[model samples]
Target: MQVNINGIETRYVLSNEGGGPWLTFIHQLGGDLSVWDQLAGYFRNDYTVLRYDLRGHGKTALSREAFGMADLSHDLASLLDALGAPTTHVVGMSMGGMIAQQFALDHPSRVDTLTLANTFGGTRPESRALWEQRAASVREGGMASLVPSTMDRWLTPDFQHAHPEAVEPIREVFGHTLSEGYAMACEAVRDFDVRSKLGTIRCPTLTVAGRHDTGTPPADTQAIADAIEGARFELLDAAHLAPIEQSHRFAALLETFLERPV
Candidate 1:
């Protein structure tokens, strides 16, 4: 389904449509709502699951103006209002994690629980330069140019070799991503810096890190957990895209967390 949000047409899917709490899933850079297919499928039978494509990515209308995290957060908040979802359990991965952090900060009343996976709170100067370079590259060569390196960064070599079928979907998603959207998201990531404000997050939070994820690294995720009071942190045996690379385990962890008392 599609909804007019913040003057952009946002594409989203709301599963298990019955009345109840909602589990909102946010995708990483170069990802669409379909990126949450496996996880959403796992949870929809037992809980309400909502997934959407951020502006400029997937089927969502691209924005002509450059956007930042604040814009993305407003987009999400507006979507929830449009759907009349009073409050939601938010789960975000990678770039989505950064946006989730901002959303929870901006609209604390609407967020029931916060789950951040395989994402960083901030980027170092060196990493910011890398982000800039990658953004420029995508703008010049399109999403295809980053696929080879991104695939390596996202999944383990063994997983890539053993589960070619699993990797193809991710590749297709990347291939379909709009270069302008990807580039703008990269800029948002480059400027991401919330380390000082993480302590203010009052919701129940879970931080999940991939043991083998080199992009964000365990340290980066740990810092996020450390900053958030009472936030639980766990490490998964996968790479960046743990929810995809180790879907069952990731789903189990998330399910258990969601079921915990408030």
Candidate 2:
């Protein structure tokens, strides 16, 4: 289904199983709602699962006007309001994780729990430079030039070799991403600086790190977990795309966290 959120046409899917509260899945940079297909299907039988394409990816089209992470968070807020979801368990990875953090910060009462996977809270100088360079490359050479490097960073060589079929779709998603949209999304990450404000997050939080994820290392994820009061942290034996590479394991972890006593 689709809805107009903050003047942008947002595409989303909601699975109602009539059992539990809403669980919303947010994907990584250059990723669409489809990235959460496996995870959402895993939990759909027990929970109402929601997955939506971010502002500039998948079926969603980007506006010519400038927007930032906060704007993305507002879009989410509008989406939840449209769905009449009072509160939800938000699960996010990579850039989506950053958005989840911003969402929780901006709309504290709307988030029941926050699950961050293979993501960062803020940008370091080196990482900022790296993202800026990537944005430049995308603008100059287009998505094709970035696909090879993105695939290398997103999936380990062993996984890529063993799961070529699994990797192809993601590769195509990255390859087909609009350059303007990709560049703007990169700027959001490049300018994001929320490390100091993480302590203000009042929601129950689960921070996950992929052992082989070089894009957002364990140290970065660990810092986020440390900053949030009583946040749980775990490390999975996968690369950047842990939910895809280790679907069962990731689903199990989320189930255990979300189902635990409050």
Candidate 3:
């Protein structure tokens, strides 16, 4: 459940069912591995599902020195090495999607398929100030300050009213996030940009966008698919966290993509 990867105490779980190729899930910023609970459970039947907390979130420890997206990718690389997993199909949402792109570009050989959901090809210029403001606000008021806004952004109003239970876990994860870790990760995301380098990704890729997701618009997600040689883009009728809002549809889409990529 916990292992030291590149000196960071990373928390991760690998399912033993089927003993098939690994299907790894990476969560978004301010959240932990649990964000992929339903998705992981769905895929565990056929693929060896892996759900892990990023370096600065959940039970994982952050680095003392400065770091970047590449360092996070290195952490993932070391994690697979520790687990003795040769290759994995990576599915990432929001910030996790950025990490997947970085991993695919940096360590191409280790990734079998890349599925980026509700993510961006690069950090937009306007997003820098927003991220900085959030980092400052959380550092000052703690993680609770951002919960309301995050929930509103992640889920549409209709879904929140219809299914409060589904949103509770995400709220808990984001609210309980360590301020230091969240701020540290904020910097990583603030400085991340791989738009120009997206062409380097050689693995079969899938890009997903939430139709109502304002954080990463559908056009942005489509651009990512366009940049990659043969990536496909799909749009879902949900907000930022489409997988949770429409778990069955997302799972079915992913199942098809992994079974027979085009």
RMSD of each: 1.2, 1.2, 1.0
Query: Which has the greatest TM-score?
Result: 3
Writing each residue's lDDT as its tens digit, candidate 1 over 42-161 gives: 888777789999988999999879888989999999999998888999999999999999999999999999999999888787888988998899889898888988999999999999
lDDT tens per residue, model 2, 121-149: 89987778888888898999899987887
| lDDT for 31 (candidate 3) | 91
Question: Over the stretch 40-129, how does candidate 3's per-residue lDDT look in tens digits?
Answer: 888887999998998779999877876788998998899989998989999999999999999999999999999999988788887898
The candidates, ranked best first by lDDT, are 1, 3, 2
In angstroms, the error of model 1 at 252 is 1.0
Compared with the true structure, model 3 gives a TM-score of 0.97
Model 1: CA > 4 A from native: none
Candidate 1 vs candidate 2: the lDDT winner is 1
Instruction: Give the TM-scores of the predictions, in the order they appear.
Output: 0.97, 0.97, 0.97
Q: State residue 261's C-alpha deviation in candidate 2, in Å.
A: 5.4
How many clashing pairs in candidate 1? 0
Ranking by TM-score: 3, 1, 2
